[model samples]
Target: MDNLPISSKYRSRPLEPLGDAEREQLAERLNDEFARGGIDTDAYRAMLDQVFAANTLGEVASVVASLPAKDTFAVPVVIETGTAAPGELLPARTTGLRAPLLLVAGLGTGIAVAILLVVLIIL
Candidate 1:
């Protein structure tokens, strides 16, 4: 069998200081990779700006680390369209349900938890 090249040897890029064209190429490649990874383009651009603002290689690495890690799992989105029979009242209401329900439930839960915690501390 023929000998195969080492993966590390193929993977390593030259470490010489980047020139203007090289920097632009690198940025383009990074943006492409970010987009392919399903990242928000605007957020990635903001992160790129932060990376450029970094003075040192270490600072750039820190900026990269500070950006949220790419999501590992792909969630398949299901768009559901409901059609009700003519003149039938749909019990599930979408309008104003989300914010109001969430706010009320959160506030109620928080109050209950606070009361419980206070009672526990007193007892």
Candidate 2:
């Protein structure tokens, strides 16, 4: 019927002629779905307006189908590091020295302290 909305006709059959009210109702349904997903009402309204203005039933259906149904989730990401080069895998090098240097320093310190004490006693 000419008086009925286009959306209802479209729903019933693709070839059916659509009326303005049905188009508006379908747009509203799309907007409502988007709003439920936390999209701002004003933005949803604008999108609905665009959907309503679509000339073809296919275009209107496309817009309605585009509405997000639920919260979107991203896939977890993983970072991979390549293997180290031959010698580079070894522990870091220290500037001061290791066991040999520590032994020398310790002996020198002990001698220096002993000499100082002897000199003090003599004085």
Candidate 3:
């Protein structure tokens, strides 16, 4: 047993010690999950405490396991294809007073032309 390689000995180990960087990374992940509404305030505080108190990678893994899976709680994505069917009238984009103002202007022009024609005929 004493002659076994260090790697082989560690392979059977139940818990591997965690480094500062690993612990911080796990803490950050927990914080992100909390911010995304995956976990509640009580759960966040509990998990955060567990993250700091964890001495090994296995301990951190247990803490992570208590939270929801990332994909399960993630927001759904919506993609839109702007294509319309042939001859389909898509919704018109409006600038304020455009259609109404254009109609008024066109009618005014027609009325002025009619009045001018009438005056020219009378003269």
Candidate 4:
């Protein structure tokens, strides 16, 4: 028999911290395994403890791999970076505080300067 690796390993990163969302997902899957009798009571408790105590993605992954019926699951991620469609009725700008205030103040100053120039021209 040829000796081969049973699972893929994340070789590049050794200590990537797991995010809160991922941790919750791992805990949920652990619960499912426990409910389906894939994990015994003793082992289920231990794995639940490990899932919550896990600090890295690898830790949670290891727990998942130990399940009797392994899923080999990977969560899908979607990110939208494109702007809105053309002719779209986009909402008004709701950020920043100084730009509008400065514009109004500058307009007043410009009007004052224009009035001064007219008065001078008339004199």
Candidate 1 deviation (Cα RMSD): 18.4
lDDT per residue (tens digit) for residues 73-114 in model 1: 777787545697766777885677789998999999999999
In candidate 3, what are the lDDT values of residues 10-76, reduced to their tens digit? 2345387878987787788888888989889998898899889977765666565655544435555
Error of 1 at 63 (Å): 4.9
User: Of the candidates shown, which would achieve the greatest TM-score relative to the real structure?
Assistant: 4
* Candidate 1 residue spans exceeding 4 A from truth: 1-22, 63-123
Write model 4 residue lDDT over 1-123, tens digit each, in one string. Answer: 012134433223426887788777777878888898878899888888987897875666557567544456776677545598966776787758788989999999999999999999999
Clashing pairs in 3: none
Per-model CA lDDT versus the true structure: 0.55, 0.63, 0.73, 0.71
C-alpha lDDT of residue 22 in model 1? 36
With a 3 Å backbone cut-off (N, CA, C), the pairs that clash in candidate 1 are none
Q: Summing lDDT over every window of 10 consecutive residues in candidate 1, give the lowest-scoring window.
A: 1-10
- Which scores better on lDDT, 3 or 4? 3
**TM-scores, one per candidate:** 0.29, 0.33, 0.43, 0.45
Candidate 2 Cα outliers beyond 4 Å, as residue runs? 1-16, 38-46, 68-123
The alpha-carbon RMSD values of the candidates against the true structure, listed in the order shown, are 18.4, 20.2, 17.4, 11.2
